[model samples]
Target: MPFQHPKETGYGHVIERYVTRKDSDHPRYLELGSRRVLRPGWPHAERFTRHLIDDAAAITDVELEALLAYEWRSRLTAAWLIGVDQRTSFRERIGDLLLASEVCYSGGGYCFALARLGTHADAEILTAYLDRYLPRTDLRYDQPEALGALLRLDAHLGTQHADRFTEPDGLWDQWVQALAHLQDSPDYTPAEQRRWTDLHCDFASGWARP
Candidate 1:
């Protein structure tokens, strides 16, 4: 059989456990894929990218299922997880740290492994996260890697993708386009992982539009 769209598979139903935040007895679900990432003893966790790869693999054969299957955290985690999982380089591996960042917020991490793989283009995965879910108020997600990925993109591409951080304009359409040097990129303010700077709130609230 072919790889079915999630809508067609049994595992898709299992994945829907995360998607709908629902649970079942026979369908084998993590029920907490994102939460499982937070455990102190998560295997291979010393390596953030690998851990995400493992976590995502544990969920489904097709990584995109994890992308499609859930609460935004699992989805965002899936973004980083799949990004690193897909990298074909091994020379990039280094010591473990807070990529490890999303759930824990412990900070103090070395380089982002995905970025190290020279996959600045992979920011598209996280871009999907922002584009897909940022407008809603129901789900909560964490993306320490997102901020790191943006910086890595800046370094790699000589572009300054907007900051959903200290500046309201980083995520603004103008800079995201300038950074990609494309006619367009996903343009909007994301509420996740922000510390509520007045400028950030202004962008989110539409009080400060550019």
Candidate 2:
């Protein structure tokens, strides 16, 4: 699918009012913490990560739902909050956003949230995403993260939900092929490349990355 930036929010709409907002001068935790996670040697990254997790866990369900109803940044943070709190109530909404892929940069957050939810129903949502979107290799979207989440859940739950996709010439192959193009794109950067692998680790560990 082609990229489409979301349109509707008014110009100068205040983002700081959202629970996902960082201090007025600081970057959102997802943006800064993700970079720090990829480069663990960064000073104070671990401490910051701990704070981020605590803050996420503290967000109320009403605040979280409001975040989900906003743009990618808010949605991403909201998903992380739900995952951190194991708020299963938002599983369906997060799954719907993952499948919708309505906005950019939030799909990984949705996948991670589902992985943290850690239930058969969560696995079903991840599997449905893979079944529907993995065939479209042209769109990199969040297929890899979704697959990684499902596989991790399968390992922990002792199920084979990912077996069908991992077989030779299956969805896994499509995902790999998609990655090659993503890597080859001129806009791709080392940080961007590492982000995917970092997300895999985050999924496996339920966003507890250091």
Candidate 3:
């Protein structure tokens, strides 16, 4: 039988086609096969997440929360789809979701994603989690990557409610501390700095007085 459009037959058939591929050893075949499933309107992204959650696969509760907390539109949509399918309590589960996303995923992009989500009503729990997570000096706070993620979160969400750690406290101070941590490291590329600076400056200038 020929593969039908999602509208013609729904998403289950599409998933079945993707999962049944026998040529797992062929990279090009696998890539094309994956793309075939992920094409713009297939709707399997949500279906996959929901399947994973419902089956209670090896994925941990924290991992599930992280998947839900992902900032990418596609990923978030998938997470929402999963939440809808499971009929889980989003408000009750939001804190864990945010924490899992923040802790498990690294990179400025993830931070920005979390910040965007933070603007929502469910994000207050996320903000509270950060307050508790960032202050533990005993933990690995010295890493520039960790600091960068914090800076990105603060950059997007603003730093008013959280307690200050770096001296000369305020948003600027937090950013500077993050920058300084990255300064001596060779791995800290200029492009990353430029990106962070652009976001930081744009945000800072928005509130500047005439």
Higher-TM-score candidate of 1 and 3? 1
lDDT of 2 at 19: 39
Error of 2 at 164 (Å): 0.9
lDDT of 1 by residue, 1-210 (tens): 122345554445434433333223221123223334344565633343232334434554454443334333434333333333443332122111222223332111112333434454444444444444333333333233344444555556676453453264433333333434323422223332222222222221232112
Q: Could you give candidate 2's per-residue lDDT for residues 1-210 as a string of tens digits?
A: 442222232312324543335542355645533534555465655554566677666666666665677778777766766776678999999999999999888888898788888899999999999899988877778876787788777877899988898787676665665677664453333233335544544633554645
How does each model score on TM-score? 0.33, 0.74, 0.32
Candidate 1, run of 10 with poorest lDDT: 91-100
lDDT of candidate 2 at residue 31, scale 0 to 100: 56
Per-structure clash totals for the candidates: 4, 0, 0
Q: RMSDs, each prediction? A: 14.5, 6.1, 13.5
- Error (Å) of candidate 3 at residue 131 is 2.0
Best by lDDT: 2
Candidate rank order under TM-score:
2, 1, 3
2 versus 3: better lDDT goes to:
2
Please, what is the whole-model Cα lDDT of each candidate in the order they appear? 0.36, 0.68, 0.37
What is candidate 3's TM-score against the reference? 0.32
